[model samples]
Target chain A: MSGLITLVSLMYLVSAACYVIGLHMMRTPKTARNGNRVSAVGMIIAVIMTFLIVINKHEATMTGSIVLAAGLILGLAYGTIRARTVEMTDMPQLVSLFNAVGGGAAAAIGTFDYLSLTAGSHISFAFSFPVALDLVIGGVTFSGSLIATGKLAGNISGKPISFPGAKLLNAIVVIVIVAAVVLTIGFPVNAWWLVLTLVASLIFGILMTIPIGGADMPVVVSLLNAFTGLAVAMAGFVIDNQALIIAGALVGAAGTILTLQMAAAMNRSVMNIIAGGFGTGDSNSAAADDVPVNVKETSPDDVGVQLAYAQNVMIVPGYGLAAAQAQHEVAELAKLLTDHDINVNYAIHPVAGRMPGHMNVLLAEVNVPYDQMKQLEEANSMFENTDVSLVIGANDVTNPAARRKGTAITGMPILDIDKSKSVVVIKRSMSTGYAGIQNELFSDDQTHMLFADAKKGLQDIIASTKEYLDE
Target chain B: MSQELYTNIAIFVLSILVGFEVISKIPSTLHTPMMSGANAIHGVVVVGTILIALEAHSVLFYVIAFIAVFLASINVSGGYVVTDRMLQMFSKPKKTDDQKQDGGDK
Candidate 1:
C-alpha cells in the first residue's frame, strides 16, 4: 500500500511538471494549442494516479468501490457533455463553475473530519484548524463563484446594485463574522460561533460581489480561484498532506498574482474594487448618446493604396480588435504589405483590451510572430517615424486622457499614437468604453474613418493591399 | 464521516446548479466585472487559512502554519500585481489618425 502511494506521488510530480510547461506554452498565442495538449496529458496522468491510489488504499469492498467508480463515471460524463456543448462566449462562466467545484471538494474534506470528531474521533488541534479554515473559505468560494457565474451569464444585473447604507451594512456583517471567529477560539466546547461564522461568510460573499459591475468579472474570477487554493492548502494542513499543501500554495499564489495584475491593468485599487459598486447604467447610456462625426470615410481600396505605397506602417489594436475577431485578417493584411517591401509592425498597448495582455492573445490567435508585436514603450518611438498608423477597433485605451489632467480618464497612461504621421480608424461607430466618455481621437485631422465591421473591413483591406501590390 | 461527505457532496452539486441557473442569463459584456467583484470576496480564504494556522498546537503544525502564511502572502501580493497591470490602461493614450503629424514629409 505504501509503495502504491509512493508511485502515485511520483506520477503527480511528473504531471505537475507537465502542467507547468503547458501553462507556459499557453501564455503566448502561438503555442496555445500545444500548451493545451500538454496540460491535457498532465491531467490524464493525474487522474490515473488518483484512481490507482484510491484503489490500492481501499479494502476493495464491492459496495464501496462500485459507488466510487460510479461517481467518477457520472462526473466524467457530465464534464464531457458540457465541454461538447458550451460556446466560447460562455467559457468564462464555465471556468467559474469548475473552480467552485474544486472549492467544494476542499470544504467537503474538512467537514468530514469535523463530523468525525463529533462522532468520538480524537483529532489533534492541528487537524481541526485546517479543517475549519477549509470549510469557511471553500464554502465562500463555492457560493461566490456561483454569484459571479450568474452575473456573467446575464441572469443577474452586471451593473453594481446598491441600496442606502450598503457600505455600513457590509462593514457590520464583516465585523460580526470576525467577532464570531474570535469568540469560537476563546471558547472551544461551544463551537456554535463557528457555525454562525459560516453563515456570515456565505452572506458576505453574496453581498460583497452583488454590487460590482459586469466590467470587472475576470478579476473577480481570478481572485476566487486564489481563495479556493488557500482553502485546499488549509485542508492539506489538517490532513498532513505535503503534496496538497505545495500544490494548493502554488495555485493560491499564482491566482492572487493574476487577480492583482488584472486589477492594476484597469487602474483600480483592490480596496476600491472590493468596497465600491462599479458601473453606473445612466453614465453608459449618456455616453452612448455622444454622436459621432459623420465624416465621409475612405474605402479599404484607398487605405490599401496608402499602405502599399507607404514605406512603413504600424497597426495599433484595441478592444475593438478582439470584438471584431479581425486579428487573423489583420495579420494577412500585414503579411501582404510586408511582401510589397513595406515595413509592418503591430503596436500593442499594455491595457488595450478588456484585460491585460488581451491584445497579445488575439494577435497570437492569428499566428502573429512574437517579435512583430511591439510593446507600447517600444512602439511609441517608431510611430513618429512611420508613414501610417492603422487603428483597429480601439478607443479608450488609446485616448489621450491618460496624460491629460482634468479629464474623466485623466492620469491614465495612453499610447503615443498621436505622434504618428497619418492614422486610419476602423470602427462600426464611435462608441465609449467602460469609462463612458467621448474619444477625441475621432476628430483628429490626420485620422480617416473606415466605417464598417472590423472583420469585414480587415478582409477588404487585405484584398485591396494585394491588388495594390499586383498593380 | 461518510454521512458528512454525502451532505457536502449534495451541497456541492446544489451550489453548481444554483450558480449555473444564475449565470446563464447575464449579458456577455458584464461577465468581466462580475468576476472581478466575486474575486474580492474570495479573500475570505486568506482569513480562514490564517485562523486555522493560529490554532496550531504542535511543532509539526507550526511548520505547516508558517508555510501556509508565506504562501498566502505571496497570493495576496500576486493579486495586487495583476490588478495594477489591468488598471494602467486608464491613463494610456488612444491612437487616432487626426492626432498624428504628417511624418512622410520628414
Candidate 2:
C-alpha cells in the first residue's frame, strides 16, 4: 500500500510537469492546441491515480466509492456539456462559474475537516489555521464569481449598486470575519466561529462584486480565480498533500499576475479596482452633451470604395463585435480587401472584449492567420501609415479624447485611431461605452460614421466592395 | 513534522515563482486559455476529495466529501475540455495568405 501511494505521488509530479509545460506552450497559437492537450492529459492522470490509490487503501468503506464515483461522473458530465455547448461570447461568465466550483469544493473540504477536528479535544494551530483560511477565501470566491457571472450575463444590473454607507457595512462585515477567525485559533470551545466565517465570506463575496460595474468584471473574475487557487493550496496544507500545494500555488500566482495585468491594461490599480465602481446609469456624460458634435454619416458603398482603394486597412474589434457575433464577417471583409491588393491587418487591444485575448480567440474562430493580428504596440505604429482604420463596435478604445485631458478616460491608453489618414466607425448608435463618456473622434473632420450592427455592417461592406471591384 | 511543513512551504514558494515565470511570458492573445489551464491544474485538489470520500468517518463528512469530489472533478475535466476546444479552432489557420509565419511559438 505504501508503494502504491508512492507511485501515485510520482504520477502527480508528472501531471504537474504537464501543466507547467502546457502553459508555456501557450505562448503562441501554433503549439497552443498541443499545450491544451498536454495539460488535459495531466489532469486525467491525476484524477485516475487518486482513484487507484483511494480504492486500494479502503476495504470496509469501498461502498463509499459509489458516492464518489457518482459525484465524479455527474460533475464531469455537467462541466463538459456546459463547456462544449456554451457560446464563445459568454466565456467570461463560464469561467466565473468554473471558479465558483473550484472555490466551493475547496471551502467544502476545509469546512468538513475543521468540523471533524473540533469534535476531538486537540486544537492544533497549524491544522486549524489552514482550515480557517481555506473556508474564508473559498467562500468569498464562490459567491463573488456567481455575482460576476450575473453582471456579465445581464441577468442583474450591470451598473454599480451602492447605497449610503455601503462601504461601512462592508468594513463591519470584514471586522466580524477577522474576529471570528482569531477566535478559532484562540478559543477552542466551539466550531460555531467557522460557520460565522463562512456566512461572512458569502456576504462579502456578493457585496464586493455587486458594487463593481461591468467595466471591471474581468479584473474581479481573475482575482476571484486566484482566490480559489489560494484556497485550494490552503486546503492542501490542511490535509497535508504535496500535489495540491504545488498546483494550487501555481494557480494562485498565475491569477494574481493576470489580475494585475488586466488592471494595468485599463490604467487602474488593483486596490482602486477593489474600492471603486464604474459605469453608472445610461445617462451620457456631460462631455458628450456639452458640445454640439458634428456627425458625418456615409453609405456602405462609399465606405467599401474607400476600403478597396486604400493601400492599407486596419480593423479594430471590441466587445460590441463579439456581442453581435460578427467575427466571421470581419474576416470576410478582410479577405475581400486582400483581393483588391489592399493590405489588411487586425489591431487587437490587450483588454479587448470581456476577457483578455477574447478578440484573438474570436478572430481565430474564422481562421484569421495568426501573423496578421497585431498587438497594441505594433498596431499603434501601423495605424499611422494605414489609409483607412475601420472601427467596429469599439468606442472608448479609439477615442482621440483619451490623448487629451479632462475626461473619464483621461490618461487611459487608447488605440490611436486618429493617427490613421481616415477613419470609419461602425456602431448601433451614438450611445456612450462602459466609460460613460463621449468619443471625441466621432466629430473629427476626417472620420465618417457607418452606423450598423457589427455583423451586418461587415456584410454590407463586403457586398459593396464586391460591386465596386466588378464595376 | 515541523521539518515536513518546511518542505511543503519550500515547494509552495518555489512553484509559485515557476508559475509566474511561465505565465508572464504568454501573450495576451492566449490569456483566456492560459487562465483555464491554471484553473484545471488546481483541480488536483480532487485528490484530497477522493481520499476523504474513501475513508469518511461519519455520514455528514461523507456527504461533504462527495460534494467536494464532484465539484473538483468538474473543475478539472470541464475546464480542460472546454479550453482545448477553444484552442483547437486555431490549429490550422490559413497559411496560404501572403503573410510570413511569425515563428514566435519557440
Candidate 3:
C-alpha cells in the first residue's frame, strides 16, 4: 500500500511537469498546438493515476463506481460535441461556458466536503478556511461566467446594465459573504452559514459582471478565469492534493497576468472595469445627428480599382468582421492583392474583437499567414507609407477622434489610418461604435465609405479587384 | 501547521512563480489559446470530485459528487479540445515557416 502511494505521487508529479512544459511551449505559435497536446496527455495521466488510487483503496462500491462512470461519459460526450461543433466566432462564449462548468465543479466539491464534516464536531481552521474560500470564489466564477456567456451569445444585452444603488448592493453582498465565512469557520459545523456564503457569492458574481460593457469583456473574461483558478487552488487545499495545488496555482497566476495585460491593452484598470458603466450604449446618436459632416461614399468597383492599383494596402479589422463571419472573405481578398504584388498586411488591434487575440484566431482560421498580422505599434508605423488603408467592420480603433480631447474615446490609442494617402471604410452605416460616439475618421476628407455588410462587401471588392487585374 | 501542510504551501508558492514566469513570454497574438489552455489545466478538480464520490454513501453526497464529476469532465475535455482546435489554425499556414526563415536570415 505504501509503495502504491509513492507511485501515484510520482505519476502526479510527472503530470505537473507536463503542464509546466506545455505552457512554456505555448510561447511561440509554431509549438502551440503540440503544447496543447502535451497538456492533454498530462491530464490523461492524472485521471488514470487517480483511478488507480481509487481502485487500490477498494473503497468505492459498485453502485458508486457506476454512477461516477456514467457522469464521466456523459460529460465527456457533451463537452467534446460542443467543442467540435461550436463556430469559431462564438469561441469567447464557449470559453466562458467552460469557465462556468469548471467553477461549478470546484464549488460543488467544496460544498460536499463541508457537508461531510461531522455535525457538532470541532472543525479546524486549516480545513474550514479553504472550504469557505473555495465556495465563495467558485460560486462567483460560475455565475459570473454564465452571465458573460449570455452577453456574448446575445441572449442578454451587451450594454452595461446598472440600477440605482447597484454599488451599495454589491458592497452589501461582499459584507454578507465575509460575515458568513467568519461564522462558518468560528462556529460549529453549520450548513446554514455555508448556504448563506454560497447564495451571496452567486449574487455578487452577477452584480460584478452586469455593469461591465461589452467592449470590456476581454478583461472581465480573464478576471473570471483567474477566479476559477483560485477556486480550484482552494479546492486543492481542502482535499490535500498535490496535483490540484500545482495545476490550480499555475492557472491562477497565469490568468491574473493575462487579465492585467488585457486591461492594459484597453488603457483601463481592472478596478475601473469592475466598477462598470464605461459605455453609455448608443446615447450619442443625438450628438451624431446634430453634426451633419460631409461623408464620401464609394462603390466596390472603385474601391477595388484603388486596392488593385495601390502599391501598398493595410487591413484593419474589428468585432464587426468577426460578427459577420467575414474572415474568410477578407483573407481571399488579401491573397488576391498579394498575388497582384500589392503589399497587404493586417493591422490587429489588441482589443479588436470580443476577447484578446480573437481577431488573430479568426484570421488564422482562414489560412492568413501569421507574419502578415501586425501588432498595434508596428501597424501604426506602416500606415504612413501605405497607399490605401482598408478599414473593415472596424470603427473606434481607427477613429481620429480618439486623439483629441472631450470625446468618449479620448486619450485612447487609435490606428493612424488617416496618415495614409487614402482610406476606405467598409461598414454597414455611419453609426457609433461600442463607445457610443461617432468616428471622426468616417468624415475625414481622404476617407471613403463602402456601405455594406463585411462579408458581402469583401466579396464584391474581391470580384471587382479580379476584374481590374484582368483588364 | 503540520509538516504536510507546510509542504503543500511550498509547492503552491513555487508553482505560482513558475506559472507567472512561463506565461509572461507568450505574445499577445496567442493570448486566447493560452487562456483556453490554462482553463483546461484547472480541470484537475475532476480528481477531487472522484475522490469524494468514492467515499459518498448517502444519496445527497452521491448526487453532489456526480454533478461535480460531470462538470469537471466537461471542463477538462471541452477546454483542451477547443484550445487545440484554435491552435491548429495558428500553426497551419505554410507562409509562417517561410516568414520565420526570412527573419532568421535578417
Q: Which stretches of candidate 2 lie over 4 Å from their true place?
A: A59-63, A279-288, B94-106
Model 2's interface RMSD: 1.6
Docking class of 2: medium
Per-residue lDDT of model 1, residues A1-471, tens digit only: 778878876786676555445444444334434544564465456556755655555443444344344434454455445544544335456556655655655664554445434443344445555565776787788678778878767687766778889878888988987776554444453446556766777777788778766556657777777778677666766555433454455456546666775676566767767764433446556656775675447899999888988998999987677666677788788878876788898887655654435576456445555577787678887988889889998776677755766555565556777778878989897656656777777677777889898899989888888887885
What is the C-alpha lDDT profile of model 3 across A23-116, one tens digit per residue?
Answer: 9999899999899889999999999999998988899888788779988999988998999999999999999998899999999999999999
Better of 2 and 3 by TM-score: 3
Which residues of candidate 1, in runs, are more than 4 Å off?
A1-53, A59-64, A80-91, A119-125, A150-157, A179-199, A277-302, A354-356, A463-471, B1-106
lDDT of 3 at A33: 88
Index of the highest-lDDT prediction: 3
DockQ of 2: 0.61
lDDT of 2 by residue, A110-141 (tens): 88777876443667777778888998999999
What is the Cα-based lDDT of residue A321 in candidate 3? 95
Where does candidate 3 stray beyond 4 Å?
Answer: A279-292, B95-106
Q: How accurately is candidate 3 docked according to DockQ?
A: 0.70
Cα RMSD for candidates in order? 12.4, 3.5, 3.2
